[model samples]
Target: MLKLIRLEWRKHRFAGNFLGAGIAMIGILLFLIMIGFLDQGTEDFAFLDYQGSFILIDTFARAVFIIFAGVLISKLIISEYRDKTMNVMFTYPIKRHKIIAAKLILVFIFTFAMIMVTDIIMGALLLAVNQYYGFITEPLESKVLWQMVVKYTISSISAAAMSLIPLFFGMRKHSVTATMVASVLLVSIVCSGFSGSNGPTMSINSIIIIPLTLGAVGLWIAALSMVRLETKDLN
Candidate 1:
């Protein structure tokens, strides 16, 4: 498994996706902060409030990283099939399921780490901005910062796991479009429905459980697809 992951990393080491994601992360954070400043009069805007700002940032970060994960899965997995490199992979001695697992594991780790790091950076930047501008109602407190860290941690993990949903579509026909489309829809639903003024529709615990459950289902489908791959003609 480690070997497979190493090989996957080598394949993507030169790819511009990571660099692009990094740029996008910074861009998105700045954009959200700008909106907060521009919309200061709009109390309904979640970014205007400190706690609301964190919630907005967390929701947006999750959505962006989830889409980024979908793109990674599409490029890493679907593109292999599209380009006929999957047949080359099939020739390897490693079990097909192990290969799939390794790829998924890489996606999960990358997505989770990116979201967590970006969220932390964005949160800190917003706090600093608030300190200078006095936009936030409450002063920055250690207890509040700790709560943000915990919430961000949970949301990041859940977002990373949920990203595998696109894998199910990717495996079906090796369609990158399908994977991206699924990601867009999922992100829209998650961000628009449960985030912001509406707040989470369910308990915080359910938010974590629901995405994790869906991710597990997606992995189960990927395992089943691997079984099919064993018998299906690679040609």
Candidate 2:
């Protein structure tokens, strides 16, 4: 498993690094601009409030994941069919389940790392702006901060998880772009319909769980579908 991960990492190092650096830079720029608008001599609104921050974080975090998921899904799954590399991949001396698992694990790690990097950059920016402004409103308690971070992280992962549905279909027809677009549309529809006041704003944990489950189901189905493909002759 470690070897497989290392191999995938080597292949994707450029993409992963680029994603991290790009997001961090964006975060820093946003923070600097926000700080510029702050009252330099006052201590008012210097802290971050969970409620207000939640709105911004939730929206931005989801948007970021959606874009990344689309690109990554297109690249990772589509590339296999586009280049006719699955023949080589399936020829290897590995179990069919392991191949799917490795790919899934790579996606999981890649998404997790990206989100963590994003959070770190965004958090630093928020902190810098707060320090310059007077603190933002009232900085979140450590517990609240961590909770929000974890919640947003899970949400981001779940959002990416939706990509598996499209990948499953894409693998069958060998069209990654089509599945990628379908995945985005499906996720957008679900999120738009299931999110907001029209739906339950239950605890953050509940919100995370709902999509997490959906993603898990999609992955399971993808895996099973891949098993069938692995055995079928491409010719």
Candidate 3:
């Protein structure tokens, strides 16, 4: 398992760095722009709006990050099949289950780490700017920060898990990129319907209920499909 993880890490090292750097760069840029505006001396920084700001930022940035994560995980998993490299992989004495597990573990780790790093950079910038400008009069609660971190992490994983549908398609047809885009589009449709009045109608609880249920279902489906793939014919 360790060897499989090491092998997967080597395969994805460059891509992982690119994804992490992209997240950091965008996060820092956003933080800078927000601080720059706040520093213009006309506006006061009030933490009263922090909750709304957190939600808005989480909605936009996390959505983008999740899409990136979906693409990264799909590409990582499908690359082996798309290139017909699995045959060479199978030549080694490694177990197929281990390979799948390694991929899953690595994707989770990479996505989680990237997100945390983004948060840390943003938080540090906020702290520094608040210190000098006294824009935010109230102290920022650590608990709120932790909650945002947790929520973003879970959201990213859920998005990555949903990418399994495309991973399945990629495994079967070897068209990783096409399958990934299709999967993301499908998820977007579902999400849009959930929020639309004329679309999939449900109770108020449906908002919270539906997404949590779907996330759980995606995780389960991914695991089952992975297990099935380990034993099924790859040719």
The candidate maximizing TM-score is 1
Candidate order by lDDT, decreasing, is: 1, 2, 3
**95-208 in candidate 1: lDDT tens per residue?**
877887888889889889988888888888887777787766667678978986887787777778778888777767778999999999888766664444533233232356
Q: What is the lDDT of residue 61 in candidate 1?
A: 78
Better of 2 and 3 by lDDT: 2
RMSD of 1: 2.9
Model 3 worst lDDT window (10 residues): 197-206
Q: Each candidate's TM vs. the true structure?
A: 0.87, 0.71, 0.68
lDDT of 2 by residue, 1-235 (tens): 8787677667767456565648654764575456435734443322235444443444444445554655666666567757877667878997655765677666666655665666566666666656775545554588987877777677667755654666666666667667767666754654442234322233332455567777787678666766776465255
Q: What lDDT score is found at residue 157 in candidate 2? A: 71
Candidate 3, backbone clash total: 0
* Rank by TM-score (best first): 1, 2, 3
**Taking the tens digit of each residue's C-alpha lDDT, what string does model 3 give over 1-235?**
7777888778777455665668555864676577557644533322224443343333434344445556665666676666777667767787776777787667656655654555556556656766896755566788987876676566555545554445555556567667667666645643342222221232222255554565566567567756776456375
Q: Which stretches of candidate 2 lie over 4 Å from their true place?
A: 12-48, 186-206, 231-235
Q: Any idea what lDDT model 1 has?
A: 0.75
